[model samples]
Target: MKLYGSLTSPYVRKARVLIHEKNMAVEFVNEDPWTEDSPVIGRNPLSKVPVLEIGVDSYMFESPLVVHYLDHVDGKSFTPRDPAGYWQSQWWQSLGQGIIDAGIARVFETRRPLDKQMPEKMQREEQRIHRAIDLAEKTIKENSEFLLGNRYGLADIVMGVAMQYTDFRYPHDWRSRAPKLNQWLKGIAARPSFVDTQPPGFEPPAA
Candidate 1:
């Protein structure tokens, strides 16, 4: 399998981390979706990064679906089989993905020509990110060691990459707002999967 995506994409990071955790041997192909000549467009109509090519014809897009497919292929599944835990994990995963969506919007908005950029849209995205973070803080505060329960699963992987991306792009003092979350991230950062897949660099938008 070949995973195609840029190092800076949080969604791509989620897929990469999951593959690493499962100890799956998959080729990593760095493809920037924004480039005019990117090959990702050929694999996915949406021209999105993190496209997983299983074979000559089989391909999967969307980080969640890619991770889900990887989990089913081999190794211990990150998804809980029990009904209650399974639903809880899915709920948290949605919230985590929400943060990524908002953050990505904000990043793109900032990258637009200064005069064309929409302050209102950027503000809305910022609010969405903050709200998601607050909910995540409360969830972790009440839940077990990880997002779904005591065991680490998909929820943790999704949220971990989301928070890291938030730090990379927004430059917020999230630790002060969510200390518990900060601690949780610290623990997960030590994992080989996360450390190996850390974002290449902090490239904040120029003023």
Candidate 2:
């Protein structure tokens, strides 16, 4: 399998980290769609990174779809199997994706030409990220052993990348606002999946 995407993209990181944790072998092809001549345009009609080639000339887009496919390709399921834990994982999965989406929007909004940038849109994204995280803290604390779906499952993997990327691109003192979330993040740093896939030139805060 060949995974094509930018190394710094959080969406791509989601796939990379999962493949690592599952001990799956994949050839990573760095493809930046922003370049004048890019191959991602062919793999993904939408021209998005993280397009995974699962078979000869066949591919899949959308991080969640790639994640759901890859999470089970290693002869076992990495997601929650029980009824309640299954839904917990699903909930976090949605929240995790939202965090990354808001973070990406906020950062890209700032990259726009200064005059063309919309402050209100940026502020809205910022609030969405903060609120989503706050909700995560409350949800995890309310349910014991549900830090990332009652155990380390697909939801944890996705949310871990989301938070790490948030800290990387969106600078803030979030550790204070969500102390439990901060501590949970620190614990996942030791996982080889995360250490090996750390974004280029960006080091996570010291554990």
Candidate 3:
């Protein structure tokens, strides 16, 4: 199996975490989708990061699908096989990933030259990001440690990737404001796979 994606992408991080958690041995191919040479375009027409190719045949794109498929393939169960537990993880994953999209957009907007930046759009994204963070923090506070039930499950993994993205892109402000989440993120970061796979530096994807 092979995974192709940029290290900085939160979406990529989610797939990477699942691979590690499942102890799956797969080659990690570094590819920048923005570049015309990127093979991601061939596997997925969307040219998105975190595309997973299974063996010589099947393939899956997008972080959510990649992780979900991985959990399914492992058969050991990262997600609950039951309906309620399944839906809970699904909801948290959506909320968690929504923040990632907003964060990505916010960063892109900020990277633009001052004259080209759209203040209104940036403000909207920033608010969305904050609300997402608050919701996550509240969930963590209500649940003791993991997002779902007692053990760390799909929900934790999904939110973990999202929080990691926040640290990689936004850093100080959000981290300081959400101390408990920061602590949780620290624990997640301590995992060998996460430490090994974290995106290096702050380079932006090519236009």
Of 2 and 3, which scores higher on lDDT?
A: 2
Cα lDDT tens digits, model 3, 1-207, are: 899888788898888887888789878999989987777788999999888998676679988888888888867878877899889889988998898998899899999999999999988988998988887777666325666777677787778777777666775477556767766666666777677777787432211
Query: Rank by lDDT, descending?
Result: 2, 1, 3
1-207: candidate 1 lDDT, tens digit per residue: 999998889999999999988888899998888888878889998899789999997799998888888878785789999999989888988998999999999999999999999999999999999888887788786424677667889989998888888888887876788878877887776789988998888542221
Model 3 is weakest, by summed lDDT over 10 consecutive residues, at 198-207
What's the lDDT for residue 71 in model 2?
Answer: 84
Give me the displacement of residue 105 in model 1, in angstroms.
0.3
Q: Judge candidate 2 against the unseen true structure and give its global Cα lDDT, from 0 to 1.
A: 0.86
Candidate 3 TM-score, C-alpha based: 0.88
- Write the residue-wise lDDT of candidate 2 on 1-207 in tens digits: 999998999999999999888788899998898876688888888888889999988999999998888987776787878888788888888999999999999999999999999999999999999999889888767434336534677788888999998989997888888888877777776689999999998888774
lDDT of each: 0.86, 0.86, 0.79
Clashing pairs counted in every model: 0, 0, 0
RMSD of every prediction: 3.3, 1.7, 4.2
Error of 1 at 111 (Å): 1.0
**Model 1, C-alpha of 193: deviation from truth (Å):** 0.9
